[model samples]
Target chain A: MRILPRTAESGSYAALAGLAPKRRPSLTPYYFILPYLVFFVLFRLGPSLAGLGIAFTNWQAVGTPRFVGFANFEAMARDPRLGDAFQNTVFFVLLTVPTLIVLSLALALFLNQPRRGRAVGRVVVFMPYVIMSTVVGVLWTWILDKDFGLLNVYLNFFGIANVPWLVSESTAMYGIILTTVWWTVGYDMVLFLAGLQDIPHELYEAARIDGARAWGVFRFVTLPLLAPTTFLVLMLTIINSFQVFDQVYVMTSGGPGTATLTLVQYIYTTSFQFQKFGYGSAVALILFGILVIVAFFQIRGYRRGLKGVE
Target chain B: MSRTISRAAWYVLLAVVVALVLAPALWMLSTSIKPEREIITTQIRWIPQNFTVEHFQAIVQNYPMMQWLFNSLFTATAATLLVLVLDSMAGYAFARMEFRGRGLLFMIVLSMLFVPIQITVVPLFILFSRLGLTDTYWALILPVGANVTGVFLMRQFFLSIPGELEEAARVDGASAFRVFWSVVLPLARPALTAVAIITFLSTWNSFFWPLIVTRSDSVRTLPVGIAQFLSLRAGMVQGQMSIGQSMAGAVFAALPPIIIFVILQRYFIEGISRTGIKG
Candidate 1:
């Protein structure tokens, strides 16, 4: 918690040394940045631009790539598997985003209380997040097993029949969604807790002085003040949900008839599995488009919400 | 009396949440230690009956579990160190120096945040293949150096700290590199810790690129290896691993980080919170 004061005169020493006036433009900055810039261009920036170009070409693992303008995009229009991937992805996002937002916020609020064991509670809740994604998926697949899973065993105590979580097409996406919420909800909760701590104590006191009850205080003072965090969490959750692949790859492999097929899964299969690099790049671009468009509307709606609050 | 009741209820709620969160992990541990006959039973067993270490021994003897663990540790540590050096130097330049294309270069870096890694994976694979670097540790570690978040976090951190110390060192005729290394970097420990933890955790947990790039168990990481060899649908060559063995491998893969996390929980939470609020 080192304090960094903002008002310190930054470049005064150079001025005092008379080097500020006529010092040659130094290559020092470039030298410092060159190593990272090379990596950025080669690995990140270059690949990203090349991926865009790849979308319009007929690239494959073992063939010369030819420029085929809009062919891949046109093919995506008629691709039934792509349609399923897109729909299932949207369905997954719909199921996950609100559930995660509400659940994590609830957990955050509950843990934020001044209680004796809340620290332990916070640590326990965030524990699953520390496990690798594949491990979480593997572990949950066992927990959600149809016959002898812990979940089914508990359900049967209440006279409920066992549900085929990953094997059944109808419930496969739900299984991944359940695992995801358990795996990542803690992360969102941590973010929400940080947001909760940032709200001034006097705001709550003011609301209480006005005779507001708990729900009323939360709805007005807490919710409105937490708008930015909520927006950020929402945006991050959506982007992440759109890119959901690891759990699906391990748990379902987009199976039980592509019930859990998702955008990134499609990208992986198309490019890596099928070796249709061009088509995969096209699908990846569609994912990027969806994210940018969704972000645009979210920011717009968030701006409107801010204006309303003001 | 009402306050006492509320306090009791609060503990009850906390207990329930903790149980729900921990049950799956506990189940993995339980099943790993249980004999196969007990594991396949319909009864709910929190504690294993006739507990055994046979499954753990089987996985250790049969698979390259230990090798995958070593690869994951080595690659993630290397990636973290690489990111720290590259990002801190670049971040210093961005924050304190007047340079050509400084604004645009940083903007380019930041804008990549929105571009999904899936978009770049294919071309990157191609690049690696061309360079004959595929299926190596270099393939696993190099691309992570291009990560954007560490650079952004470092830059933000450098901007926050007062520049007087670095300026004074420079005034005393310490070269820019000397000033950055000796003066600035020592003060950057907090940001460095945050970045290091985040990068290490993510790399250790990373599955996608590693899954694509590494072909054999020698270079295969834990996540990829576990998914490929020990999963329910264990890959073509290994055949399907038994549930008991799968859980055993999982416990082996999961315990190290969980232990580290419990010890370093404060830094972990602080690092995540900082990234969340700022980024």
Candidate 2:
């Protein structure tokens, strides 16, 4: 809840009074910034601009690019694969964002209790996130294997039949989603725990003194105060889900029949694998557009919720 | 009595949660050590009947596992060091100095956060290829210097700290560079450590760019190498790497970071929580 204090004015004042020895109109600040600026321009800013321009061209790996305005974007309208990729990506986001929010919130609330051994639980839960994504993908594939997978073996104990997880078109996305949730829910829980800890304990004490029950305290006191963190977690999860690629690439290669084909996977295959740079860039731009629109709505909703709270 | 019951229930819930989270990792480790015959069996075996190091030995002998590991370590460390130096200086300037167009410049840098890296990859690839820098460490190390998060976090941290020490050093006629070097950099350790850990972790786990740029095993990092060769699909198609060996490769790639996380558990949690709260 701490706000960053404005220091620029105070810094100038110190220099004016000669309390700081820096002379006015000095170029030292520029000197400090220039080194990072060089790399930022070449690697980050310049490439972003170039990518935008390339989206309009008929660029390929071996040919001189010719300007072909809006052709690639139009191609997307007829490309069934791109359509499938878009739909699959949205479905992925829908499946993941809400589930991750609720599950991680539950875990945070459970672990935030003033009980013994909670730290161990927190550590254990966050352990998987430390593993590399590709390793996670490989490990989960074996665990979700049909005949001898650990998941099916345990399910049989509960009288459940074996579920063809990654090998079946109907169940492949679900398998990746399960792996993703397991790998990342702990991260969101950690964020939510930080938020919970930020709430003043006095509010809870007051709620209990007013004869509020546990559910009442949580609903009334906890939820309202936790809005900012919830908004942040939601945004982070949504953005990450929209860009889901690593596990899909490693686990199924968007396969069994394009069931797990995501936008980034499509982009990777088109540009890198097939050397259609322009089309890939166009798809990547569309992805950027989707992220921007989602972020816009999320921020607007958050502002409206804040106004309602006020 | 109800309090005691609730406490016992908490323990049970904790146990279940822990088991669910740890099972896959434990399964990976178990599979890595199990012999091929036991790994292929249908019966559920948490403990291997016969523990073997043959899979690990085979992967090491056949694949460039150690080279991939070294590549990951070298690039991630170089990137982290680069980000720390560059971000701290730029962060110091942004926090404490007043200059023309400073606010606008800072805004431009911050705007990159919304611009995902996917947009830049195509052009970045072309640029690197033109420079003939693909399949080199510079291809991996240089782009990381342009990261936005480290700069933002560093600037926030610098703003939060009181500027009295820097001022005192400056009033003693220390130059701007001297004040920053001796007076400010030491105080920025916590922020530096957080930025370093985040950058290192991401770079080490980075798959996409390395996959694009590197053609051979000489420059492929651990994640890319694992995804290309050790994945289940890869194993299935190539018919070379067994499940046990695949698991061994996975465990080989995973253990260092996991072990580091356990050792620096506090810093890892604190650093991650810091990013969330501050962002």
Per-model DockQ against the true two-chain complex? 0.54, 0.59
| Clash pairs detected, candidate 1 | none
Expressed as tens digits, the lDDT of each residue in A160-262 for candidate 2 is 8989998888988999999999999999999999999999999999999999999999998999889999998998898888889999999999988899999
Candidate 2: segments with Cα more than 4 A from true spot: A1-24, B234-237
Give the TM-score of candidate 2 (chain A). 0.94
Residue pairs in clash, model 2: none
Worst 10 residues of 1 chain B by lDDT: B231-240
TM-score of decoy 2: 0.96
Best by TM-score: 2
Q: Interface RMSD of every candidate?
A: 4.1, 3.5
Model 1 alpha-carbon drift over 4 Å, by segment: A1-21, B233-240
Candidate 1 structure quality by residue, lDDT tens digits, B67-135 = 999999999999999999999988888887766688999999988988999999999999999999999
What number of backbone clashes does candidate 2 have, counting pairs of residues 3 or more apart or in separate chains?
0
